[model samples]
Target: MHELSITQSILDYSLSEAKKHGGVKIREIRLLLGPFSGIVPECIQMYMDLLAEGTIAQGVKIKATTLPLKVRCRDCGKESEITRRHIACPFCESLRLEILSSNDFIIDSLEVDTDGD
Candidate 1:
């Protein structure tokens, strides 16, 4: 699955950063995933668990927060949260909308054990 590639990227980046920090072991990796990002958290976590074997990130916890889908109506300049069921603007009922969020896949923070304590 694509999640394996994505998880591999995450592992690579985390390990690189940990190496910069004197080879610290990763404790947790926090991610912010938007609803429309198309990356399933469960799948990514499973892939990470498999890929992290024998690495410094092994047994690292993967935490994710799903961001809401926020859109702005281009016609009326109104902002609203929309789900997959409804994409039309609530105020002006306009289909012309600009997505403010919902396509984000970000690694927010990494918790590392630098001192080995």
Candidate 2:
């Protein structure tokens, strides 16, 4: 699954950052997942657990926040939140729409235990 690759990348980045900060173990990782990101949180968590096996990140907790889909109507200049099933503009019923958000996948923060306790 693609979640495996995503989890691997997250682990690699987290490990690198933790090393830079002299971290001994990773505790938590917070993520912001957009509605259009197409990544499943459950799969990511499962893959993270498997990938972290026997590593310093073992038992690390992964927390994700889902962002709603927001779109701006080009014709009426109105912004609205729409589900995946509906992407058209509600105000003017126009097909010309600009996606404002809900397409980003970002790692917001990480919590780690440093070596120097």
Candidate 3:
């Protein structure tokens, strides 16, 4: 499953960051999900949790944010939120639409803390 790869990437990157900072314990991960991104949040969380065992990410919390699909209609010259995945534009009723946003998956931020000193 690609989710494994994604989770691995996240861990690999985060681990590097932690190591760079002398092994800080990650507290929470804030992620931004794109509407068109194929990665499922639940699947990611489940796999990440399992993969994080014994790692710096152990006990780390994951927070996912939903991203609404946005499209620009050529006919109506308007931008609107798309609920469904298709060329269907509700406001303009036109097939001529350009996707403005969607299909974006990124790790926004990671909170890590070292031993309380």
Among the numbered candidates, top lDDT falls to 2
Task: Give residue 18's lDDT in candidate 1 (0 to 100).
Answer: 85
- Which regions of candidate 2 fall more than 4 Å away from where they truly are? none
> Between the candidate structures 2 and 3, which one is better when assessed by lDDT?
2
TM-score, every prediction: 0.84, 0.83, 0.78
Model 2 root-mean-square deviation:
2.1
Give the runs in model 3 whose Cα sits over 4 Å from its true position: 21-23, 85-90, 115-117
1-117: candidate 2 lDDT, tens digit per residue:
778899999999999999899999999999988888889988888999999988889999999998778889989999998777776887778889888884567898999999785
Q: Candidate 1: which stretches are off by over 4 Å?
A: none
The TM-score between candidate 1 and the true structure equals: 0.84
Cα lDDT, model 1, residue 47: 89
* Per-residue lDDT over 52-105 for candidate 3, one digit per residue giving the tens place of the 0 to 100 score: 999889977878887778889989889887765655688858988888875667
In candidate 2, residue 91 scores what lDDT?
Answer: 79
Q: Write down the lDDT of every candidate, Cα atoms only.
A: 0.87, 0.87, 0.81
lDDT of the structure predicted as candidate 2: 0.87
The CA lDDT at 52 in model 1 is 97
Cα lDDT, model 2, residue 5: 91
